[model samples]
Target: MQTAQLHMTMTGASEPRTARVWLHRYATLSAFCTLVLICAGALVTSNDAGLSIPDWPLSYGRLVPPLIGGIRYEWTHRLIAGTVGCLTLGLAVWLQFADPRRWMRRLGITAVGLVVAQATLGGLTVLFFQPPWVSTAHACLAQAFFCVMVSMAVFTTPEWGSRAGIRFSGARTTEKLAMTVVAAVFLQLLVGAGYRHKGLGMNWHLAGAVIVTGFVFWTVVRALRYNATESGVAPAAIALGACLLGQLFLGGGSLGAKLYYADAPQPMPIFVYVTTVHVALGALTLASAVVLALLLFRSEAQR
Candidate 1:
């Protein structure tokens, strides 16, 4: 989730201090931890444990009361989420001081804002009794925060800034197309995650996967046809495209194969694991695609 790749770069600036490197390192780690938090929240939904806590911000009215805890599944997720939120808040403050870039600082602020909003959504999910849209928004916001965090990590590296003379063809058309994919994949994920959380309407999620498949197919084709860059970006588009296609197959097959075989006599564990992998890969694909698109647009804009 730490941007496109971690190959690092040939930095001319006498590689920054250990502390500076540590800051970037923690920011990336916190962001990834947030990603897992989102997935954990999804698992809570999948297991029907969302309301098991039944109380706001306090696990049964006490902070350090119990680790053996009530509602093993639900309260545990809350504790993890609490940890992630604090980590992100720390990262936000650290970014403000560590990176002097105004835009970067603002992005950190926006990330924190998203964390707050997502926390509010989580509370509403409990207070309102698991409204679908609210839960979906919570999931969506988590993805957004992940996207920004990865970008922050990328920008912090010396190779990304004014060197490499790297220019992207942000041609409005391509940029918009990429953004459209980001929006499409994100929206589809929202629907899918909501379904799994609410434990209802497999059909709806399957339908979403189908629709997302179309958008992803078109995205790959567009990148292939018009994106002239054949260096770093070329591989990104290919890798992204392949992952999307593979995800579509895995996600669809997970549900379909489950139904098909379950109706018979016995089914393989593949069904469950397939779904798990689908969801995990879905997160990965969403993150990587957005990063690729942002890099594409950023490089293009500088030209």
Candidate 2:
């Protein structure tokens, strides 16, 4: 028993069960809430409803407004954003108390700061009547915040903590591939954000799609090739591949729906759903890439 305790302490894996439970729960909740917030933001963009309220931190000079017309989408988005901010704040505080790793506590602090900045950018988007650049920045920052929450969730997993000292062979190649995938995904997301807001980078976004897809597939292949030796890599890589495929399908559907609406000049319900979902899936893809990269390159004890 003493030997086990010593070994666990040396491995930095001596988390109490209750603390781990709370931290894991908070992390999962934060990640889910962040994803929902991203979806709401996408809906606002797809519906062209960012300025529907015409107010910052309030809707029509009131706390609660009737959920009618464009106000429904815009106000709902604000509400969700506020909820996500609170959840992230609570998560950060919880980590400060429950998590043993200094880096994780710091990550929580950074996430709190990001949520505040993201909210401020969101307000700026409304105050400035949704300037293309400001709105694009808001979108980009939201993705960053989402990535942070996802990382928190990953860090709280038992598997992550237990694998601290199990260094995999071929880690260099895995690191390079993971880093490339993450970089390409983020660059593609930035181009997508710009294109979504102002249509200024449509060509660039299209070009980036090709590059992101190639890197994503290559990363998956690399992980799978080493799966016999590194079990965790294959699962994460496969999940990333699934997200990439979903994004590609949504992208195609969005394009088709847009072209159809362009000629028909009619309301296309599917178009909004497709485009918004595409945006959400893009964020998911970025988060997955980041998680895979961190898992491949960094140990839990290192964090």
Candidate 3:
């Protein structure tokens, strides 16, 4: 009888563990799909397809439209966005039932809310013929939604819950600096988005880039120097550093491509590719800084 009871206890315990693992994996998948959706959105903007469909919640008065010219890019972006919305909704529902943490459940709900807002903004961008401010907000909100999805993915990982008590000196300072870096990166993204939509000038975006790069380096160097051995801190810091470097190169390439294609009747393929990649990498840089900041804060809390 004792053996049977023990077996049942083991089975019951294993189920929740299995569920957590699946939940983590699902969250990670949601984050990845969000990134892909960002890329698709970037592609649409780069290809000058924002108003190709001339309709929202439907393409050309139908669920699917004839995918031709810029219509292809715009329609594909919409389809991918729809898929992301479904994934986010599923993730939120799963977290509500399966996760024990109240904050995480709340975060899932927030993710759902952000996705809804993002979709609405996307529709508005089309309906209003891509007004600069509206379009820039749409771009910025996508980055925010991406950050939320990434945070969920990181929080759900087993490592996040079971992290060792790895304390480090100056953790508070590191956390503050990391938070600064995140803010800088986000602001730079805002400027870049504004520049892309022509609401702001290239000079403002360039100035923001320089400021952000300095902040990123400062945070990264501090984390690596002091918290190099911390479980999550070092890796996230390294990623942020790498992403910043890549973004710089992509930024230069994008500038050159834009100038080269300035006289072209339409956006050249090279221009589209470079600018889209720059935008995608910018999203990645912001996400990396966010992860690093969160991990730093978690470490400080554990201390």
Best by TM-score: 3
Q: Pairs clashing in candidate 3?
A: none
lDDT against true structure, model 3: 0.87
> For model 3, how many clashes?
0
Off by over 4 Å in 2: 1-15, 162-171, 263-267, 299-303
Give all candidates' CA lDDT scores.
0.69, 0.82, 0.87
Candidate 1 Cα RMSD (Å) = 5.8
Name the top lDDT candidate: 3
Candidate 3 on 1-303: residue-level lDDT in tens? Answer: 434433443455665667777989999999999999999999999998899988888998999899899999999999999999999999999988776666888999999999999999999999999999999999999999999999999888866654423354565777778888888899999999999999999999999889998889988999999988776789899999999999999999999998988899998999999889899999999999999988877777676
Candidate 2 at residue 82, lDDT?
Answer: 88
Off by over 4 Å in 3: 1-12, 162-171
For 189-272, candidate 1 gives per-residue lDDT tens digits of 777877766645777777877777777777767776777463356666777788887797887787786667667543345654
Candidate 2 C-alpha error for residue 29, in Å: 1.2
* CA lDDT, candidate 2, residue 285: 93
Candidate 1 lDDT score relative to the true structure = 0.69
- Error (Å) of candidate 3 at residue 283 is 0.9
